[model samples]
Target chain A: MRLELVKRPQHSALFSAVSPFIALALTMIAGAIMFSLLGKNPLDALYYYFIDPLRETWSLHELAVKAAPLILIAVGLSVCFLSNNWNIGAEGQFIAGAIAGGILPVVFPHVQNVMVLPLMLVMGIAGGAAYAAVPALLKARFNTNEILTSLMLVYVAQLFLDWLVRGPWRDPGGMNFPETRDFHPYAVLPELMPSAGRANWGIVFALVAALILWFVLRRTLKGFEIRVLGQSPRAGRFAGFSASRMVMVSFLISGGLAGLAGISEVAGTIGQLQPSISPGYGFTAIIVAFLGRLNPLGIVAAGFVLALSYLGGEAAQISIGLSDKAARAFQGMLLFFVLGCDTLIHYRIRLAHSAPSKRTDVPQPSEPAEVA
Target chain B: MLESILITIATAATPLLIAAIGELVVERSGVLNLGVEGMMVMGAVTGFGVTVTTGSPWLGVLAAVLVGAAFSLLFGFLTLTLVTNQVATGLALTLLGLGVSGMIGEAFIGMPGIKLGSIAIPILSDLPYVGRFLFRQDPLFYVSILLVAGVAWFLFYTRAGLTLRSVGDNHDSAHALGISVIAVRYGAVAFGGACAGLAGAYLSLVYTPQWIENMTAGRGWIALALVVFASWRPWRVLAGAYLFGAVSIGQLHAQAIGVSVPSQFLSALPYLATIAVLVLISRNRRLTMVNTPACLGRPFVPAR
Candidate 1:
């Protein structure tokens, strides 16, 4: 039998609410199968992968730490994706932000004051926005494909980061390692509740960003413009929304947020600039954005879910000797199911035995007798 | 030494050429499968694994092609049959491919790989320079060139090619004309996947002859850029691939010669050159618009 999708008269609200949950369940089933194939007890592996991490205060803090960047970056991506601007190079932007933020700590270790941290955060956002501007400017000026240009920059950004930590930014006091100097106490992001765990203000930043963006997207004209431009550029243009300007606005917003995530990751988690600063948070955020259905509030929840996968990967690695790469594979499968289930929103899928007819130019659906 | 460098450049160019040509057809048929990187990597791992276990490069190549095509069918089923968002689905495919390949390839890591030896035409192998360059290269090298020529002919000169192009240019019209838009897209996507697989196979069997996680190393993406750089023309893809191949190999040579510049800068040349070339080409809006498929990246749902 072949699958046929009949368009629903309107988008199904029921499926819209349930698809993500359905997708998550499907992923867990697939993960269990994968674990069994690898010769582990599927039940135990699943528990460690999903439940074990949530039980501990430290792991929960770790979850917050991981989710902070994802929520922040994905919230930004939600804006870009909503506006029909595909900024696939957020990874590069994240690295650029980290490098930019690290400069204060690495280059000016003597500037150990409250002002330094604030200045570094500003610089990080600017750096990411500046990096993202390359593709935005290219697209606006030259009608270039932003997807390719943005993605290409990711490699450039990565290499630039590699050059920095190894070259000029290397910690002078430390042996010749590839990492830069550690941030001074004043430069480090203040912890949220150090007594409880290592969670910092990064999660607070993520929540605030999400709440503000949610308000903007839900209750503001800018959100309307992004939706209009995304669905129909012609309609958006007719409505006086400049597509080119929107490109810049959306890119800047997303880039700035991605930069925030990068710096937060460095100051909050890593505490130094290094040859590598992120573990593909930018890329993972893309998945998070989609899984969240491009809703800022939804992204906060999705971020925690994806963060759990990372934690689960680590937990599985320790307890079951499963490869950490399995986590990525699991994530990839999650996205596939998410997208597949999203089909339920717009159409009713039917398993049919065969086509009704082989003839071309069939009559309208209203003429039911023609098919028979 | 010059001949050896040329050979290396050709080897570098071949994978790009193969992958781009395949994607060119896919785009010409109006589907953008962004998972070329993913498919290529999967191909590399499968090719390496099969070669290691089965002891034949040909078998390895065959398995890679089949696996790539099979992997792409997941995309086909999702975007084509289920009508998921092509961009998101393609990204999913790539992410999944990378993750799965990394897991599978963990076993093959650091294992000595069996290289696919070059072809040796009895009389041609002995010639001073051009003969070896032309005829004494690996089998896939000739396949790459032939693919360019064959795809160019098939796309520009064949009736079937016209049908595929028409589908890409306007799927609604094609569907109205009784052509199976979805079927044609499935075929194009599969062909792209197979070529990507072969390119991945080339990497593992011929280029470096080993399994490295992410060895495709954004080459699949570079190949995607090459398609746009070529403006969907098969012949131009050949030129663009070599241009990139030369840039990449030149950087390697530069690093080997120990140029004062940082090795990272030298290594980043290919990606930088891609941006430059994209800017130069995309500056001519008229050219890009005229060549790009009208229905490219737009999902199609046929009405009953």
Candidate 2:
């Protein structure tokens, strides 16, 4: 008789990849029930969300438009996660970037040079990287909890940006609305193939960023250092790779990319800075980074998938009776289920009877089980 | 104006203090419980539900503690039984709690809060300068302070407390000493859950008295950080909680004072100060490591 509890075989290669897929399938099934309860047709509701809008050219561009920030943020976050640094303030960095970049155009409305837009882009990224540096510095110097510090800063950044639009940056002529002056034409991201619709330069930046990150993560010495650091800080120190330095580098990179995404979204799509800009893309990027397994190439795909949820959520809000918050719940459910399924990846479950009498009632396994 | 601000600070700090001290126990037992926000929100919802259903506010508080503990079991299962990463599981628990509570509390929106009357002491509460400070409070405020003191003593002075500290320092050694590691953690985590629930219930029944989505906001996260600021000491946690509460409520007061500072800058006060404090205290790596629970947030599976 086997001494230890025997696990049923589920660690086959098929189940490894199939687990995330199964989790996704379960999420959809659960969501259908939620929709039906909310008085929406499950089939048509699902079709309207995942298909109808995506069939058009304009909607395709809209997908890219929304996915740009998600992709950029997730890609940068992947690097930070790999380096074992938890930078939870990317949302704040994105807002900071928007404020910094958006401010440039409002302040320099008169300047229409060949490089004005490029200068603003730099300013945007720099702003994000600087804001990110605060948490990194604290983590590196004092061993403070980066997770809390970074997350808390999100509120501060949101308030800071909100203050700006409501105060010094408010468009004096805009009839008491809480928004800034319209970004100058030059500062706005030029549409790629104007006929393709909302497809702006942000998508290009996202793709390029993904490519570079994928290459760096797969090929470079620094990438290896980051991997080592995340896996074992003890080993990293033994290998002489400074965990503190990696913290600073990863935070800056992630924050900078998120910032670029912010500036692009505001100037490119919204055209003016408002009190509310992002729909929690920075926070959602955490899901993307994990979903993609912290791989840059995988992040590109996860970004699109998450973007669909956001777009679909909006669609459901209009089509179904679901409130804005219910849609958010749906998205959170997807994340929860996905994380739950990942549990089986490392550990296999087993069932065994403590009492010997139970073994006589049930047939034993045909052979010793081969799990993980 | 000063009295009003002081009252607000006291009121604000009560919840933060309660939540922080609860988290402090969880961390002291070497379990980093980040599901505070979720637990608090659920407590707020259930507490409000119970208060509205029954006329007594005390029942609402009890309801919160139960709900918080129940919600915490979700976190406990993932981190303990499944042995997943505590931080990731904590985040998941928060998101799940938010979704579930928001869903359940949707119907309770706009119901009036059952307000609790202040319990005035004979001479102290009626005193000119010190009455409000010493005697005028909802019973929960004083209970929370007692909790802090009780928790501090339990952690530092008791045999069970000694066992908890030993378990936190090294699970293997504690197990060697025959102090069931998982059992102690389960007890501490449950206790933390109860505390978090009480804090959340306090928000719904005592302070705001209305059900809202994500009303706890980031106070839970602030409480977690305050644990670090307090450096694992219960008394220090009390001080940290009030400090954060002061800055948070103080911002509104500062804005109300007609301070010329932009409302945004004033709003940023609490968060900015928290980050600054984190930077200041955490910069000393040695101090951070020494006081930080050695096995905090790591799952312990009995490796037979």
**Candidate achieving the largest TM-score:** 1
- TM-scores of the models, in the given order? 0.97, 0.91
In model 1, the clashing pairs are none
| Candidate 2 chain B: worst-modelled 10 consecutive residues by lDDT | B295-304
Candidate 1 residue spans exceeding 4 A from truth? A357-372
Lowest-lDDT window of 10 residues in candidate 2 chain A? A363-372
Q: How high is each candidate's interface RMSD, in Å?
A: 8.6, 9.2
In the range B160-217, model 1's lDDT, one tens digit per residue, is 9999999999888999899999999999999999999999999999999999999999
Which tens-of-lDDT digit does each residue in A1-372 have in candidate 1? 878777777789999999999999999999999999989999999999999999999999999999999999999999998888889899999998888888888888988878998998999999999999999999989878788889889999999999988898888887999888889998899889899888898999999999999999999998899888877787888999999998899999999999999999999898998888887899999999999999999999999999999999999999989999999999999999999999999888987777733435432221000000
Candidate 2 residues lying further than 4 Å off, grouped into runs, are A1-16, A32-53, A352-372, B1-5, B53-56, B99-110, B121-124
Best by lDDT: 1
Predicted complex 2: DockQ: 0.37
Model 1, C-alpha of A239: deviation from truth (Å): 0.3
How many pairs of residues collide in each model? 0, 3
Chain A only: list TM-scores of all candidates.
0.95, 0.89
Query: lDDT of model 2 at residue A37?
Result: 82
Q: How much lDDT does each candidate structure score?
A: 0.91, 0.80
Candidate 2, residues B224-259, lDDT tens digits: the string is: 878888888899888888888789888887889898
Q: Candidate 1, DockQ to 2 decimals?
A: 0.54
